[model samples]
Target: MTNMASYTDPTVKHDALLLFEAVDSNPNGDPDNAGKPRTDLETGHGLVSDASLKRKVRDVVQFQVDEGMLSPADRYQIFIRRGVSLNAQLEDAYGALGQATGKGAKADFVAKSAEYMVARYFDVRMFGAVMSTGNASAGKVTGPVTVGIARSQDPVLPIDMGITRTASTQEEKKDNASQMGNKSVVPFGLYVCRVHYQPTRNNQVSEEDLQVLWTSMANMFELTRSAARPDISVRNLFVFSHSTSLGNAPARKLFDSVTIAKVSDLDLPRTSTDYTVTPPAAKSLPDGVTLTTVV
Candidate 1:
């Protein structure tokens, strides 16, 4: 349902990454209020607005798509939460499934798995964008997006149904609970990474700059493999920037904003049932997908 993710980087371990083009920035949700939308934090701090986050997520998701981790038809879900509560839930509930299944009884199995997945999900630890107000010809007049499900300035980066992660000793069955095995905790996920976005310059971006950013970020995302969608069409693609001033701010380079957050402090993450593997089970695509097998 989107443009395929594109990348030419080569040093990533495909199997190690869990989240495909994910993110994990600071401030959890909105600043002022930690995790809670009500509390107000300082200015020019915290993660970019929800809209900014979505754009970045989409673009990064595109990276995975471009890399062939996922297909154009692959479903991608983006969550803009205030914390990693879901991650805790998965760890607390099903974190030990691997141990019981003989995957090894390490005290830190849960933690390690969580860490790997979070890292994959949040491939980019940083995101920056130029700041400028919307101009009649181009640029965005929109400020930071509110951190809730409201009338977004744009579509949710135009994705298919969201993809939820689940782990299992067996394959996942929707109707029969019997097929579901010790899979309680989601093995991997895709979260947030660094997002450098800002108002568009009249639907414009520098090709050289875009290429460089993609080339670098692609390599970084590759580091976390097992979870990357491996398809460019699935990842979100776009440019982002911030405004240095309000009311028709002029977008400029290096005027990007900064946000930081801890994965443990938030209430996000998902758990899914396990699914056995076979060539057929490897991917799910809509009828419209036209994928090129990765060499």
Candidate 2:
């Protein structure tokens, strides 16, 4: 906290960028590191299984029928829907504690303050700067491509294949995507990288805080791609955190269920890991974790 960086300082911003780089790279730099499984984490990468994919597509179709085909009042109504959440404020002594709801709360500063704090805590963007520049290099040595057959009657072609690890050349990226009626181009990509923390007013990161962060992200990956095809494959998904600003998840068994083994299998960050933050204290964490400060 002594040598803290300010938002306006360009030097601090540059360090911020560097922090992102370090976090994305494996904290141990061990390319062979494939994390174990978490009872709390998803079993496999995406919902790229047989049964679930059909169900998801069916749901989408059903939604179109139910709402898209109906009129405004008959199909759906937007006015009845609620807006953002609000918080309640409590003061010392046996005073009044107001119940605030909706975007615009009462004329209470405490209520607004509480609401803002809650929002910042839950916002994903607060964690780090998200990168849009995905892996565009072609001819990555994808270990194997498996596109599922949609209807079973007409088998889909192999949209993805395991290009040998040593087969990578600076040739054009084989955007050569293809598939039969069965094997539709499924959402597939390499795990470029991800971040663990971002610029924020607070710096104190506790073990439990990191546990919650990973757990939430794990849940999100499942929730987001709940409807992927069986053939689809999620090459990589990871989180990057600054070594100095890393949070310690004392109780979390942060191991992924599945990972693309064989080095050069994918043009990803190389590890199945999204990225890792430099834990605040690694020495004390081997056996158990302890917090030095909390902001």
Candidate 3:
């Protein structure tokens, strides 16, 4: 009894399980630890920050919008792109509406600017933004989507592989003709992430917006390929859509229904086949909830 209808409806609450894998890649680097692969010191489990995953999602949406793959193309503009000025973008809202930015008009200006931002930028509508900086101050918006950090199912081992560059920066250095460096990577790891969507009136998340979010997540790694993470990919995306906006069951319960365990006698998993991933049985779901497999 899994119903696909209303799953993308913004009025209902949704919870998603994102399973992705990395083979010989650095999924996320810790700047605090000299760009090493992020890990938990106590358990040695691989960790990928929610911010890193969101950035990839954003990049995916932006790429699709730029290529005219998504409809209503003007509304899917990305606000947090590199080399773009947030203040400048915020200021444009006032300019577009021809609104004044004086102290007397500050409250209205902020409200209108925030509304304008929500309508124009896809990320602002879905991920929210803090636009209260610089000359134009749009009030802070709480997004409908919340992404949790991704953690490996088992303990991971991150190693640094030594490499050397053929050319040196300085031509005068005759004896030292090459420079050496190390790349941090995990041999293999399967990570699980949770993304929750709770819609509200303020952000105005639509069904089409949810489509963009889901599509972006499914193709996040493919569009964001890099030398350090060429083998990363999305293995599964399990979406749970509630019939009501308040939700029919606790998210944790739904998440628990889907179990993941290592195959018997197989240790040190190197591929997805090494583990057994089980989604919830059709009858196991709570009332007014539907589970949809998107990948």
The numbered model that scores best in lDDT is 3
Model 1, range 1-295, lDDT digits (tens) per residue?
1222311111110110011222221212334443322112333211224453344444555555567754322222121234544334333323334423223335465444333332223221112122111111111123211222212111112112234335433455534433322211112222323232332222122232233344444343343233222321113222221112121222222112211122343333321111111111113422222211121
Q: What TM-score does each of the candidates earn? A: 0.21, 0.28, 0.96
| lDDT for each residue of candidate 3 in 94-119, tens digit (9 for 90 to 100) | 78999755434568678888999998
What's the lDDT for candidate 1? 0.27
Candidate 3 global lDDT: 0.89
What's each prediction's clash count? 92, 18, 0
Candidate 3 ranges beyond 4 A from true positions: 1-4, 101-105
**C-alpha-based local distance difference test score of model 2:** 0.25
Q: Give a tens-digit lDDT track for model 2, residues 54-104.
A: 233223333433556423322121111124221111121002223332333
Query: 188 in model 1: Cα distance from truth in Å?
Result: 40
lDDT for 121 in candidate 2 is: 27
Name the runs in model 1 displaced over 4 angstroms.
Answer: 1-7, 10-51, 54-69, 72-85, 92-96, 99-107, 115-295
What's the lDDT for all of these models?
A: 0.27, 0.25, 0.89
The TM-score measured for candidate 3 stands at 0.96
**Model 3 root mean square deviation, Cα atoms:** 1.5
